[model samples]
Target: MRVPRRRRDAVEVNLTPLIDVVFLLLIFFMVSTTFETRQALELELPESVSGVAQVSSPVTVVVTAEGDYRLGQRALSADELASRLSDAAPQAREAGLVIEADGRAPHAAVVRVLDRAGALNIRRVRIATAEATHTEAERP
Candidate 1:
């Protein structure tokens, strides 16, 4: 009597389900993510009892406590500041300018930024300020 033998096929893995799960995880992470903008300069803005919320984007000029000037994230000298402002005249004029001066920043430093803006004829200028968190009794 002769016995018959059966051949076995090659073993294989189905990766479709694995790939689908990976894609699902990727989409979940993307949907759960949030985006925000951070300031380049760390500043303690002066308190204001009448501070208004800003609605539009504007060209920002930062004046540090040490009287240093920053146009965007780049440190600029007085001469450089003037040049840059002039170079972006049209945009600056259209978008307007916002000065974010530190609470302890020198008055002259802020004035210098203002002078430049005036020279460039930028009409809409606003100083960034934090809302006051004090009562009448708290005021000196």
Candidate 2:
């Protein structure tokens, strides 16, 4: 029996399929990604009369240095915040809100954020603060 010879041209990979997959992945990420937009705005908060305690499961609301507020990284206006709270899940609504205020932030700014959350039927609100750096133990 005579042996058959192999073809001179080798198989080649098509780039179009790879490009199509990349485009599809790009679109998928754009559509499915959840964006939280508080990186640009910051709110500073004045010290409170009482110490702020940590909560395990709070609806974290960050007040920036500029007094702008964000909820778990999602920015919100006063009215929108109220509306959003009203529309949140039961657990979300019940989840006490932790308001992170910068040291330089005005008291009024922090109050306003709390007021808005209150208006949305949020019962519990907590402010955020780090351990005092000026405590007697740490001082020389």
- Cα deviation of 52, candidate 2, in Å: 6.8
What TM-scores do the predictions have?
0.74, 0.54
- As for model 2, its CA RMSD to the true structure in angstroms is 7.1
Q: Where is the poorest 10-residue window by lDDT in model 1?
A: 33-42
The true-versus-predicted C-alpha distance at residue 37 of model 2, in Å, is 11
Q: What is the model-wide C-alpha lDDT for candidate 2? A: 0.68
- Mind giving the per-residue lDDT tens digits that candidate 1 earns over 2-67? 988888888899999999999999999999976544355689999988888996544788889999
Best by TM-score: 1
What RMSD does each model have against the real structure?
4.1, 7.1
